[model samples]
Target: MIRVLFYSAVSFLLTSLSCSAEQKRALEYTVSFEHRAAHYAEIQMVVPTPATGTIELMMPTWTPGSYLIREYARHVDHLHATSDGKAPLSIQKTSKNRWLVECPIGKDVRITYQLYCHEMSVRTNWVDRDMAVLNGAATFLTVAGAESTPHRIHFDVPEDWSRSMTSLVAVEGRDHTYVAENLDELIDSPVLCGNPVVQDFNAGGVPHVLATIGDSSLWDTAKAAADVQQIVARQQAFWGVVPYSRFKFLNVISETGGGLEHDNSTLVMTSRWNYRNKEKYEDWLSLVSHEFFHTWNVRRLRPVELTQYDYETENNTRSLWVAEGLTSYYEDLMLVRAGLIDQSAYLKRLSKSIEKLQTNPGRNVQSLSESSFDSWIKFYRPDENSSNSRVSYYVKGCVVGFLLDARIRELTNDARSLDDAMRLLYQRHSGPKGYSNSDFAAILSEVAGTDMNAWLAQHVETTDELDYQPALNWLGLRFAASKSEGTVAETKAATAPTNEAAREVKPAETDETPNDKREEPRAWIGIQTSDGSASVIITGVTHDSPAHEAGLNVDDEILAFNRYRVNSRTWRDQLTQLGIGETIDVLIARRGEIRTIEVKPVTEPTEKWNLKPVAEPSDEVKARLAKWLASQ
Candidate 1:
């Protein structure tokens, strides 16, 4: 028996050494969704290798495009390794998301693991009886130092679930086999498996697919498809070329809001009723356009820091304002260009962004570059102080993009604009090498025929207030604010007025009617709440507001309002019940002490900003607007 054992071990060693000499490397990933109802997937990977030492594999901590680190390795379990079915291979856990596999040189190894994927988001993976959304980063393992090696994926799904959708091209003559040039490409392509409404269209002579993974009864698929196709064609024309051979949009209508852009596709999550409402549906289309534009802006013309990604750490850069913000700026502009929305509607959206910036006190505290750099910590994790301390690069960046475009047009007599800058940047750095922050300034100057040093200093690098008038002035537009005031009816719990008496209270003898105001005045106390179950806690207090003036502190839990019990749901109603200028007692628990504070409700002024064309314009201004709007 001992002689037989020795002979067997010798034979296995010989086979491994022979395999190592060939130095052949191949990755075959088999994913099974038959047990998806249990919120897990069984994955098997067969790797043929030539390495003499240990093979290290790593699971990415975060997916690209999503700034937050999700620690996807935590969801992986039931890990086992084998070598040519000869004997169990030695595997060691090296780090939180890394494993070292002991392999005799040239030996073939197989790794089997189960992944729990209950989370539902564009960047994460999810599975259920009905459908599965698989993000490649969260589902695949990367063989350290072998990222450039070609890999193939095979899906083993239930017989009933026949449909599958992904941006990856399938291997010819291989059933369910898809090839990725490298691990990065594999990680960029997400797969959606299950029954879905799939629609195909051609834009700019490139094939496009729209796969909706939920109930599609409410949406007019044909109309939506045509609109989407127009957006694609318009963007293709704007960029002057289509980067990818084919593009796909994987949409999940299980919830509202968000999308993550990829190399050749984008995963969009939206409300089930998004199509039923005109505004919601327009927002959806804007989302689609936003992600598609990213195919050029970030996916190709990326920032220097993102040119080569390190999945284990954050790829922070001060240029996301251009990556994400510029994409946002074009979302609505592309819609207008595609005739999905009129110029008037586009102005409304732009005006809305201006209003948001003006209202956010954080705009004065955070620079666009700082906002982009700290996105990993600040942008994704918002607290009450977020509004007061940090501005959104997205909101302010779009405003800057608008101003930049107008500045370029103004300088060149509409001969060159921001589009010229984009084309130049794309031409120069459309690959593995990304542009730096200074590079953009240089490009903008070259396109505008002027020095942009001061422009970058004042806007991108500092928190100086932006003056929209200059840009608006050049575009034959003016920013105007009109004040229309209204009085709020007072209601007292002890001596509450009847409905008739409430009507009798005159609205402070004003010429302004209810119709004149764009938005009705609301009683402002300026206290924001955190997510709570039993009682609402004050998470923030706006500066100089009644809540701040009355000594309301963040983390103070509100127990009652004016002697009445109140929680998060009832607090807003309690405040709205009181009339403007009315004082009420607020019972709050602060530092283990209960106290009553006198708080008065006041009518707050809500500013309405609009960028309207000048009532009468000079011929040059009119010509600028016409030409600007007419460009791709």
Candidate 2:
């Protein structure tokens, strides 16, 4: 056992450190998906060793590519450790994080645990009747202090499931055989359990697979493969090489949201299975391209600070704007080259980003890097004040990427482009190389033959607003800004419309509902309860809300509204039937403590997230449009 753990560590450090960005580490493994009734499953890991120590096992608090610390370890359960056969050593969670064990310092150890995979979101793990979906980082464990050691993961995958496909470091043969160079390499690999609906093809001398879950009935493979190929080819051409011999696209078909990247593949949560709409289908392909671009832009080519990741702490960098935004630039570019989208669509996409950037107030407060760094604190846990205080690197970063592309073209008289800049960086730092704010400027200056310091200082670092007019004029376009709102029709009881006429009246027919306007206060009850079966379950109570003012706490089930029996889900509708300042007695079920309380409703919480149609399509918009139209 000691020898096994020690070998795993040595393999990881030796292999991962020696490889360049252009090279890929091998991964092999077998995974078993046990359908634990209707929700979640059980998984076990048998890892080979290189050189071990007192290995402390841990699950990443968050995924690297996602840019947020999701506290993944919180859900892992019943973890136990074993050493070969030496009476299975005991492993206790030493910190809030790692599992500490005093064993044969350098050897092989097998660990097992039960995971509660109940969530259906793409970001969460779910082991249900159909299959089990696990992100490599979420399921794979690491050697406490030996993160740099090389490793190989062997899975006791069930034989019922045919095979799995991923760009993760692995080779074909036994279900439980693959290599990992280091902790980062291990974390970078994503594994799929159960049947992965795969479509195999190639681009730039490497194979590509669109491995999706559920069904693949609606996929337009003819148009898809070409666009996908172009996506990889473009990035390959830019970097002058394809880092991995093979790549995988892990598509977790759902009904909403996006994806995150990894070393050789990407994990995407989308609406691909029930995909019926043509618009949605093409859009999904674009998303696939977005993540694929990151294989180089972010996963490999990164800001110097990102070369080595600190899974336990914040690894901040300003270049994410470029790493991510430039990747955004190519999402469309690949669509164009592949003919998946055309010129009109490409410009439409860029124009939309322009409009988004123009209207956001956060543009005036936060810089791109600030948004990128604060992502851990702000991006994932978005709430009411998010918009007024923070900006998105995605929005502004795309614009800067566009502007940089144009600048590169203009400076070299159309002879070179930002593509050259990206390629140069990839080749130079393909192996653990990084850049600083200064390093970034030097690179751009070298490629453009001019100073890009001022441009970046204002746009990338400081809060100085964008000079849209000039940037658009340079690309031959226009800009506009307008207030957008949210949907009001669906909320029959969310709040009492201050406008008496609006009491019974419905929301306007416009596409968007009014934004978080500081309009007249309607009424806020300050209780988060879901109405169900003519009753309400009080999930939480804010500090001074009418509910809290009167007295309320979480886990209290509401039995009635004003003595009228009403369940949790329907309480809101019942409230909208009444008017503002209306005082009511609430009935609830709390640990057998049946109680009634007086409360008044006020205005709802302030506006936070906003999404609207594009209004400003700038000069650089054409590139984006071409990509979108081509995707179609």
Candidate 3:
């Protein structure tokens, strides 16, 4: 009778299951970070439901948009776990990236682990004496079985720290931490910290904050604030609307190549600017403006394929050049509108980037869609042949932006431009349901009153380089093109090779195009790594460098270079002994595999060392250029 009762209960439970093949379960977590201990934090999680299947806990190998897997899991330490607040739950490492947590099959499990985390990385969990820098997608731990279930993270921050910046949904009581309903949202958010000097101001009657760093006082705060204020104001004035409730400017105090945009905030890495270099300062202001404009463009006003971002794969869209490139054009235009940059400087910047794209080889290998789609690998982790294999969507896209804008202005008789297209995009696809590629072209046609098929098919789809002549002529501008090597005589030339058997000799000389192939590489590549201490480790062997010919191998930590003791203070002294072709005996430890390789240095450098921008301004171009300048 008992067996009959059990069978009936099992049948009823099975019949009651939801029609939807239940997506896994979620693990709830509370993490407490103490600033006193630089690299330690406590994490507690309760895994509920779907206990029968194996769960895979993962940390993202890389961040979105910024390609390159850093293997973030290597940094985690002391990860002890449990079930239901009790010690000793069975967990095993299944792979470098996965952990299998064994529980009573289908049983609910609770866990807690203390992570010893320490790294100054922007995309991983970092806790220092200063503040915590958390990128949840790469740092948070999920149950192996609950990777699909909705999860939560509650943060506990040190009381003395006043401000934190992120767009994540914050728990009501979590002091310094935030939450993500699912893993996707967690991947998109990066939390900023360290008593961010918060300043609130109004733009277009909407509130925004310039979350300055402690070193922010170095700049003329009033000018920086006014720059952003007017850019926002001009955008609102043009679009006739403001999309965000508030905006945050995370002014990080680091030397940077550029800024990345977020929904309500922009994480900008930059150093102190000079009050004297007003022109350069204005250029930077335009950079900040570009990122701010992205809030509407790529962030909300997105392509259909990009609407549902899959953190696991590339979010490719054919329209990024339009989205990002158009934004770049507007960023400068906004500066012109705000009277920050003169029209001439603005047009010159545009002309320069356009010329660069047309001259690059990679433009032939990749289309705009392919560029956007493969950005996860190509755009960020550039390589020796990257210039030959890819084109920056930023450079080429902006050219298309200029041509489209000019065409729109000329076609509409100065009444409308890309700005109208953007406003329409904001109206139609601003809140969810991003625009499709076809929809964008339709809008362009509506504004211009002409079919943009040939232009789109040629420049956007096919690898045909953009022809900016007709567009430039529309504004009575004369396009310019020049090639002269003598213009940059002051810049160092790429050294010629003394022998034929060495590395490929850099080009002897090339045409005077800004995108000319003769520029020097950006770094010195001889196989050596530095310990935080005085030790110099031979980490790699260049193919045909003096080190490779001299028989140097990997893991051979250096002892001395040319008899100079390579202590911390004497490191630079050792590097001086090996200037291009000057050979010296290197003493090293190849993991206690100590050896020496003597290499001869050549008189000519093995590489090019610097790059300069070439100018090609011409005559008929001068008139349209004058009008553009006058507009600014």
Candidate number achieving the greatest lDDT relative to the actual structure: 1
List the candidate 2 regions with Cα displacement exceeding 4 Å.
1-31, 38-54, 86-88, 104-109, 120-124, 169-172, 221-223, 479-632
TM-score, prediction 1: 0.87
Model 3, residue 202: distance off in Å is 2.2
Question: Each candidate's TM vs. the true structure?
Answer: 0.87, 0.71, 0.68
Clashes of each: 3, 92, 14
Which should have the higher TM-score, number 1 or number 2? 1
lDDT of 3 by residue, 1-632 (tens): 00111212323333322111244334567767753375877777777744364455665666654545566667666665555556466778877666777666555566666666665444555566566666666667665434445655666666766667776555455565454545665666667666776667887656677766545656776667777888777666666656655567766654443676766677665666643367667767877888888877887788787776554445666677777778877787778767777656666666557545643557767887778667767887875455557888787777777778778877877666777777887778865688887888888888888997776777778776456556645554443321223334433222222243223221112122222343532112244444476666554444454555677666666787777668644554346545644567677777556667676644322222122222343554455444443332
Q: For model 2, what is the alpha-carbon lDDT of residue 327?
A: 81
Q: Roughly what TM-score does model 3 have, to 2 decimal places? A: 0.68
lDDT of 1 by residue, 150-192 (tens): 6778987788787778877675556666766678888999999
Off by over 4 Å in 1: 1-24, 480-522, 530-539, 559-584, 590-593, 600-602, 617-620
Give the winner by TM-score: 2 or 3: 2
lDDT per prediction?
A: 0.80, 0.62, 0.61
